[model samples]
Target: MGGEAVQTDITTEHIERLITAAGSHGVTGAIKELGVARTGSIVIDELVFRCEPPRNRHAVPVRIDLVHGTEKAVHVLRLADGEPVTSSEEAPEDACVRLEFDLAELVTLVYGVPRERSAGVHRSELLLAAWPRLTAAYGISDHELMGSVQRAVDSVLGGLSHRRPSLNELAVRYGSDKWSVIHWFTPHYDRHLRDLRNEPVRVLEIGIGGYAEADSGGESLQMWKRYFPRGLVLGVDIVEKHGLDAARLRTVRGDQSDRAFLASIAEQHGPFDVIIDDGSHVNEHVLATFDALFPHLRSGGFYVVEDLWTAYCPGFGGDDENLDNPGTSLGLLKGIIDRIHHEERDGADPDHVARNTVGLHVYHNIAFIQKGVNAEGRIPAWIPRSSDEINPR
Candidate 1:
């Protein structure tokens, strides 16, 4: 033989250990071995890896620079060699050749590295079959590995004042156009709902749209589903939305103003972490739904009323001049503010309002009610009996 090809020795055990540790420290654990070198030159004429669905929206393309030793004959896995793609327009210019993996998929594949492979195999059909076959072959028996990799990527992307994607990003990702729903609404949602981003929550959104047609609505429902990857999104509308049903998403036809019907929906699929009234925009319907459902919200859950401006318009049930209409949804929400400060009144009854109304946030056309027992202890006002007692700290 004129020349011999050096075999690149790699093993599943080493890759698995590296990934396992990366869970705790994020992708930083694997960066030392896998990160692209500061200098661009490399001697190895070997495989290059490029991953997609990058950790951040503004993510630069990442590469690994591996240096294989001729003496050891071991294959070195390095970051891909390329300038980081900084802009969104540049990312998909050549989307076809790029190997994209979500956090779990990449970790699972890394854990199944085979021993002593050729560079040719890496370039062949092996990469295409790697995900399922490798995952099935070596198998990540420990569930922790999957979770670690997911957290690792998220943590790495979310570090050093790098915020997670905003609702606008989710909207763009899922094509929801939630921003058009209300200009200021999505940011407020991101602020309040940040903690529940990754939770396996049950979300109920009222008003599935579609009008009288069975194939019509559920735009916001789709948005909610995409935003909460682990969430179950359910919608209730008066119109039958037979076409919108899918895995993790379900819709029911019902009347928002009917207390019994509303109660039944809750009974069947409630105790929800988030509930949004995006339905009729009718004042009576809004008040009726809140009274029926607010009591059922889980502790620390959120209840959002979108389109509150409808409360001041007669079509939905309000007088533009009189906000004091007891029958109007706006009036009903205003009363809750009184209840929030109920303890401040001289003869206030502690049990008059639900003790769990922790906070109420009002915006241009939205109202966010936070549910939890108001844990702040209060002291009743007392006239000082003596001068020394008046200044008591």
Candidate 2:
């Protein structure tokens, strides 16, 4: 050939891998046939999948390539839920969030790296698929949505943050404003931080107790440290044992429900850009703390409370099973979320009237709550005034 088309070297191992997968006998002892195929090298990456139902959410393992973030080639395979839309065909310009996997992300997932923790964006579609199968075998929701429910919320929020303008366009055409409701704080930890100011931003999270103490508070504080290294994070726990490096995060001692205690911290701290309660899950404490310190929140700040199931749990305040003994306070979150959802504030839900349910979700499995400031808000009454003290009955 006058000009040979560039040919790269190939390996027999890569060839055999493909054939083996094609002939791969699945658990049923049948030959495996995947719907799609490609070849690429593995590199450091992560994979996540979220299914909201009427659907369950699951996460795949954390796959880490020992090699540096470099490139390598390997075979690629895919199985789509509905149809295959390749680059040539292009996913039809549509109203749905689409999935696209980099070659490295795909390879790492299929190779099945060992994972110590499998949550957050570290979750993968493969894990989600396998989890249901596993639960089916055990016949239990044992591997319920906890490990990855927040990941699902993250997916929705991530998509919404990117497609706000598209969503507005859809609303104008569809004569429906409901899409905005759907997008609110869907996946948990669904954080949308405002631009960090030149002033050192500080965040104080209360009730870093047990799980929230470990996961939400710890992880969120870490995120602040990472995303806004110039920022400071403080965590307070009831047990006085908050996790994380305390140099950056100061752990305080006091009942999150106690106005005196919370006010003290607020007074000492002066102001905070963000304050989250992962604590008492006690409604009184949540409402009280919000009232006392919310004003201290920086303009456009975020104040979030996690695990709002208490409002509906009879033991907490509403009438639900105490199956898990999530504690009396967990139920309070239900009321808080309900208030946010119904906007049972000063007036009716004018902004939220037709919207009986808020974009806020009641994940029966994990009760989480979130709130953000509206710079232009008239601030509704039902949002809970700090001093509307409801003594625990």
- What's the TM-score of each model vs. the native? 0.58, 0.36
- Cα lDDT tens digits, model 1, 206-255, are 88876888977776776686566445788999988967765457899899
What's the true lDDT of residue 198 in model 2? Answer: 21
Worst-scoring 10-residue span by lDDT in model 1: 38-47
What's the residue-level lDDT of 193 in candidate 2?
Answer: 47
Model 2 residue runs over 4 Å out of place are 1-191, 194-199, 210-220, 242-245, 320-393
Q: What is the per-residue lDDT of model 2 for residues 204-318, given as tens digits with 9 covering 90 to 100?
A: 8775534433433344443343333234667777665543443334566677777788778878775887677666665566666766776667654566655556555555443
Q: Which stretches of candidate 1 lie over 4 Å from their true place?
A: 1-165, 173-177, 350-353, 383-393
Residue 200's C-alpha lDDT in candidate 2?
Answer: 50
Top-scoring candidate (lDDT):
1
